[model samples]
Target: IDGFGGLRSKTKVITGVSLPASIESIKARLPVWNFDGSSTGQAPGEDSEVILKPQAVFRDPFRGGSNVLVMADCYTPGGEAIPTNTRAGAAALFAQKPEEESASGPRRPSHRAPRRSST
Candidate 1:
């Protein structure tokens, strides 16, 4: 995961206003279990932070059964998009020095196949 092309930052928050009363209550009772940076200016009660809880809907499309979705806070800053889940692709492109020592060449493709002629 080192030497990613660029740094990517992203933040995901689940607020109470987006969920039902049940979720809000749950968050009120157990705010520690909720994601951080979710403070939505809601008043802080004696024991509750008046925060919103994520929606608690369970619907599975692949399994065709009830499922629970747990929300998480993901922060990715300047993250480079690397397809095929290749870690090496995320790193900086390798350049080769050519006739000009001051300049370098572009990264060559990792995989190349011989050309084929169509009949």
Candidate 2:
């Protein structure tokens, strides 16, 4: 104890780094775009979010996918997790992709192969 009821010396350590690629990109882009968090220019209900961008924060940039990061206000009043909304939104977005259909039909043989005069 030094003087005013406080500890004198202490040591701190870093365990891990868990920043996502998307978030890192956002932070990097901040200077280029000059995005200010002013109310007039920002998106609706953006101020209510804790972690504004989840995918951006957790994604790996080197892998190279999902250029845009989506942030959803998915929290409940009771602090309970709501996964249904997020899952549905992702599903809807995924459905937009076009699927290829096969043009070939099933083949059926007219006769059996060379059964030597069984009759």
Candidate 3:
């Protein structure tokens, strides 16, 4: 998800190293990447380069094997978390709270409350 807790995505082509490599090693070898955030409503066109840092890895169920999906945190070129970097804040809160105590999910305003079913 993008920093704003919205579901936005961009795919990066993997090269050189393949699976069997730890996520940390892969992240260590990769340089911080930037993308134009204007399209995502994250930044203005003139200064839209948002930097990404890999934070976690998930198995790529689509590709399977050692292939993985990366979870990243976004930041400005100045090294500050983007204003919408809710992941960082969530991480901090998660760190302080036990796993079971934490509630997580995208909270879209357009989603309606759960409906009660009649027996």
Best by TM-score: 3
Q: Give the Cα lDDT of each candidate.
A: 0.31, 0.33, 0.75
Question: RMSDs, each prediction?
Answer: 17.3, 22.7, 6.0
TM-score: the better of candidates 1 and 2: 2
- For residues 1-119, write the lDDT of model 1, one tens digit per residue: 11233332223344453444453244343232322222322122332222223323333355442222433222222232313223223223322323333222233345579789897
List model 3 lDDT by residue over 10-112, tens digit each.
Answer: 6787777675545556666656778888888787889999998887666789988766777778888998888888778887787885654555554324558
Q: Which lDDT tens digits does candidate 2 get at residues 1-119?
A: 21133322222222443345446555443211111222222223444222222222234355445433333323333333233234435545556753733232223335567768867
Candidate 1 global CA lDDT score = 0.31
C-alpha TM-scores of all predictions: 0.17, 0.18, 0.66
The lowest-lDDT stretch of 10 consecutive residues in candidate 3 is 100-109
Could you arrange the candidates by TM-score from highest to lowest?
3, 2, 1
Candidate number with the higher TM-score (2 or 3):
3
- Looking at model 2, how many pairs of residues clash? 2
Residue 74 in candidate 3, Cα distance off native in Å: 1.1
